[model samples]
Target: MSSSNHGLARKLGGWQLWGIAVGLVISGEYFGWSYGWAQAGTLGFLLSSIFVAIMYTAFIFSFTELTTAIPHAGGPFAYARRAFGPVGGFIAGFATLCEFVFAPPAIALAIGAYLNVQFPELSAKWIACGAYIVFMALNIVGVSVAAAFELVVTLLAIFELLLFMGVVSPGFSWDNFTHHGWAGSDSFSLSAVGGMFAAIPFAIWFFLAIEGAAMAAEEAKDPSRTIPRAYVAGILTLVALAMGVMIMAGGAGDWSKLANINDPLPQAMKLIVGSNSGWLHMLVWLGLLGLIASFHGIIMGYSRQIFALARAGYLPPMLAVIHPRFKTPHRAIIVGGMIGIAAIFSDDLIQIAGQPLTANIVTLSVFGAIVMYIVSMLALFQLRRSEPALARPFSAPAYPLLPGLALACAVICLIAMIWYNQLLALIFAGSLAVAYAYYLLTHRQRAAAASDVLLEGNDAARLKPAVARSK
Candidate 1:
């Protein structure tokens, strides 16, 4: 419990962690996944989604074992560090930072787009920047307060999705879904298969960053029990909601029409009820809740990841400081918020080769996610062999089989994205190279400082004693 003194209040339980998990991902249900439809059409995207869903289901089950056993704010970073040493840990932590940090600006832009539907005069960029300021302030106040707000917004967002399904269900048509089934191909061919491969990132959008719930382990009450339950409940809820929203939207009208748009759900709602109808209006207002839930939740996620890395000497120590009164990672949260806001304003629509900037950012984020997934799965197997007596409150069901499959699926997704987004892939690789080089130059000094702090009865004492007792 050295982390308790690190200043984060462990007020979250199963329900609150569930909210953070679902909230972190619910925006996917509202927007980004439709870009898959743009790539492969309805049938193509649906097939891609099925494979991604299988990957996520397997990964989540295995990931919970690490979460419960390690129960650190670093999440995958901690797992990799324990199993692979500093190098592997930095890779996992950096990838996680990329995944959580890059995601929010996209969601914030979507929020701006949603509001633009109502008030056409206000600029989306300004609106998004303003949102970051407001939510970041809310987050800096306290973990319990921020999580409670997340739960309320997450519930409202979930209700809005269900309400959307109900209204659009009656209008669903089989022909509309199949109209441009394989990106307008006459039938399934080699070209169609290639498109499906290209669509993997967007299909992943449906469940991307759901693992963020694990980042809250340090803030969760009885994380060994609460983390697994929240993860299980959260993924199930997302699977059901993702499938429902995709099917309803694709079947309601020409699926192609909604593809690649920033606000697919609202557009789909307009198909059933006219553009200016009350239903459409309701969706625009309530839909902001979905974007807010994710925008808020991911801010919480990235701050914790930054805090963990800083605390472990992988980043600037300043980021590790917790607020005295608020007891939150205020510095970490502000740093992440600043980065996201910068991304929002840099609205470079230029395509890297053929991929748009937004798609490129999303692709970069997925690249990070896939790397983390691969490393974490590898860490799980390594830990199993290396620490046979490790206290695991919850074991991954089916053991090697599930973790193995998760690894394979993640590897495939990473390959697909590289093939489709070569330039963005290179950019991501370059960023990692720079970060790793920096780590190599400074890690020894930081580690020495960290060791000194640990010996002085600080947060590291909490971790050292636990491991010693276990040995």
Candidate 2:
């Protein structure tokens, strides 16, 4: 099929990109909320909020340079393919798939937690299954459907947060904050930084997926301009929201109380707003809707990245195919949905097995992403020093220094993950090592094939403007 006829539509705008960022980050409950509160007390919350903000800034700056130059649909895979080669791109893309693959069950579990609050009798697995169905439907329809759904969910989440923030702020006790002060009885010293690093996965996970926002670069109008603005703005907004939520929630009650409560916001709301006003149902529904919207946003991103990887020859070609009628990557969408469904069931089995499900899975994702980020920042530096002539509308401030700090933090966080969650750390590194071995064996053939396609892509990209001008 001709490219245009394939229905691989590309039409998204700045606001929609913002929606993507909001949706991805706001889905904090799925991974961060539960894990973060448990792992880090007040200090962990503060350090993670700051660390993620800085790390995201670094990632955004590095990614903005690439998106401005390439402005393609494939996101990191495309960048890696162009900069490192087909094998590098494949690794980048596959790592992303792993993150998302693990994330679906994590989100399902989070949704299950929220649902359990309302309908105590319903199994969490069932709620996760229901959430998956709703998001899958949103994704299958089209990008526009996904975008619209995300915008609604993003707004509702923000509103729910606003309500929580408003309610908790007034009721916050300073004594609640400073009283016990810092978990495990540690004074302000170098030791505290160690705690921050250990808590980094759960804390930083909240801000991790802002990079997914760039997945919509091809769809965005004026990507070179829209991408950087949307990307930076999204990260900033998420950091602000996270800070507000953690501070308010922590202050409204003893930070220690959060460890006991499954749903901290509802409990904090109960403490501040009280239950008799009949607003409890609204809060519950609002929170539930936020989780659903967040899941919808996640599925959209994961599927798009899968489609991108397939298109770039990182996966089987069948996954790259667009629907002849719908112009959507229907195959990839279904695959992602299936993974999510499987996640729900697997989580249920874990409960039945009574095995200790270490929060290590969460740690694995954070470590893997940080490793990717480190590689990406290195790519950015290489590009700047090696390809100074490359057109860049946006550049990271302070040249090497600011981005240097960001890279340092990412590396430090990776080391901390190893220190705290060695098993997960080993698994993450080992998984990549396996992918590298596979690449080493088949890389030559893959490179030849990818090169031919990339050349065709370049020719097509050059011809596109002329073709439009002629018309």
Candidate 3:
């Protein structure tokens, strides 16, 4: 295939897609962050993890259907436009942008926190800034670099998880399974459900870039065959990793010890490997490298989203521009990097995006992305019903049923997040509304101008005389 035949670049294959998914899955280290809720009590953590897993499962299927149908350069944005029109596309794309914009800093912040444990002398901000610079350079160079980076990072992540599980041979207290102690406090009951709800957004956030694999659909060697297969494999890989980490780490340590450490993986390692082993130090750094890879995945995902939006006329057209030499979404990559840099200065740096001021900001992004998923799923049902004859290379299993479950779970998760953080939900919804309003006004003005030209009759297609007008 000619290089020009594909938008941006046609460099990604099934392995690249798989590596991106695996890299993203292992990046956030849920067990590392969610250990707080576990320390609060086992049930709280278990319930929250299950809730997130279910929601995430649905999201994967939902993405699979849409990505399979319209494997375009823009991913969700293009699907929304084709299914719901330009305004719908704008909202979905913007929500995704909201998700992506928040993500880079969150990962950077987490990486900085981990660095603090190892290098207390250096500033977290400097380390984070440096990490962003490295990842940005990798992305601008091309997907090949991004894929290679993801491959190494993901492998390290796996090694770290396995090594930790191995070192903590006997595991921790079985009491952790039934212990009802709530994290942050000791109230465990229906009230803990509120705590679980409070935890939902970030729980969902852990899986933020899973859909990013879809962004590479246009570049995949065989999108129709590759997309669905990749989606299934990616989701399975994430679930296994998350569950394995939670179970293995949860089994090996005192829940409260996990609660104390800001970055859980290092703490877990300290417990399993102890301070004496030089080999343990190498393993710990492996986890850090995984964090770095996760950052790269987020950058790649959101940059493509920005590129998609620009291509669809939702943002400045420059955002959609591709680098002639690198064959990547160069403009969007730069823009996303700038957004990450600015996020470092925001006041709500630690505050989560949703309610009680405890809402996880990264989780808020996940909530918004779920909203996009719902939109895309609905689009799938509508497209199927309205255009039944349209050629579909690969339809999801059980047609409407599988997709329906995914949509239903998405709505439930959205409601859960809204209950936990009405303000964040309102912020997301309000921002999208403003964007949609702008789209409508611009579209209407353009239409009116076109109509005026039509009403001008022969003047619309007039042949000008050689003479000048009065002006």
Candidate 4:
């Protein structure tokens, strides 16, 4: 098939790119970050959050370099391939695939849990499955339409978070937030430091998947311009919102009560306004927009990844076939949805170390994400040395400093998560091993034979018009 026939349509502009970037992660604002409270009390998790925020700030700033220079849907996968060839591409691609594929089920379950707040009789698992089906359909219809929907829901999600902060201001109390804040102790001790590191996965949940926006680079109308604007703005917005919302929730009431549950905001609201308040009701309803936004956006991310990998013969080539009418990766979209739904069903079937199923899934996803981040930063350094003339519309500002900072933080998070969740880490490692073995046996030769043009991204000649316009 021709590239024209299979290529994703360029329909996303800067604002739309912002939507995907934020929408891909806005769910963290809603439910998952509270899990950090369980691992580290408010003070300890706060420390963890700050650490993660620093990592993300460095990662996104440096990552924008790869997105603009390559502008491929494969994202970190493409960058690694360009830097180190097929083997590196497969590792990054597999890690990214794990991150994107595993995330939505967790988000979908959150969506089901939110709706179950109003309708207590419904099964959250089935509802999660239904969500996977509905949003996957929406994603399959068209990227422009999906992106338009993403923008609206992401805006609403952002507004709802800000409103939560405003609504809780009356009851906010620093004394309440600070009391027993450091892992249930008034002051930090050596043991509390353990909690801080153990909380790294959930702290990461605060801004996870923001980099998924880079997967949409192929569809971005002007990647070199839109990606930097979208990414830089997205990171800053998420950091402010994450800290603000966490602080507001902690100060509202018994912070311990909000730690273990999935619906922290509504529970925090109830602590102040009682469960019957209209404000609480509004949050329950409007909060779905945040979960839905991330759920839907992640479906878009994983599908594009699957499409990219399959197109390169890393998976079945049929997944690369774009829908003629919709011009979307319809097959990839459906396949990923099936995987997510299956994961939702497996929640009851699998138990790891008595941990809640959602927490386990979150840890797994974070592991994949951290690995991909490490690989991507290394790719950035390698590309700098190898592809010296690659048209970089946005360079990593501090070169080795910023990218190295990102790499160090990612490695720390990976180590922390592995220490805290050894069983899950083993599972993730084993899966990666199995997948790589399969690739070597079945697809490595084809990947080796594929053209290096996409891998090298020596597209200076093609980027001439865009560069001229920029100049």
| lDDT tens digits, residue span 1-471, model 4 | 236546888899999999999999999999988888887899999999999999999999999999999888888988998888778999999999989998898998998899999999999998898998899999989999999999999999999999999999999999989889988899889878999999999999999999999999999989999999999999999999999999999999899999877889999999999988999999999999999999999999999999888877788878888998999999999999988888999987999989878888888899989999999999999999988987899999988899999999999999898898889999999999999888888653343333436664665356445434543
Between candidates 1 and 3, the TM-score winner: 1
Relative to the true structure, candidate 4 reaches a TM of: 0.96
In terms of TM-score, the best-performing candidate is 4
Q: Which tens-of-lDDT digit does each residue in 350-371 have in candidate 1?
A: 4576655567677878999999
User: On residues 174-285, what C-alpha lDDT tens digit does candidate 3 reach at each position?
Assistant: 5653444454454666667677766666566556678877777777778877777777887887777776676666655665666534476666656766766664566556
Best lDDT among the predictions, by candidate number: 4
Candidate 1, residue 201: CA error in Å? 0.5
User: Of 1 and 2, which scores higher on lDDT?
Assistant: 1
Could you tell me which 10 consecutive residues in candidate 3 have the lowest summed lDDT?
Answer: 448-457
Q: Where does the lowest 10-residue lDDT sum fall in candidate 4?
A: 443-452
Candidate 2 wrongly placed segments (more than 4 Å): 1-7, 29-31, 186-191, 260-262, 275-277, 348-358, 437-471
Q: Write the per-residue lDDT of candidate 2 for residues 104-220, one digit (tens) a residue.
A: 666666678777878899988788888787777667778887887788788788888888788678889866765444444435555555656667777766776667766777667
Question: Comparing candidate 1 with candidate 2, which one achieves the higher TM-score?
Answer: 1
Name the 10 consecutive residues with the lowest summed lDDT in model 2.
447-456
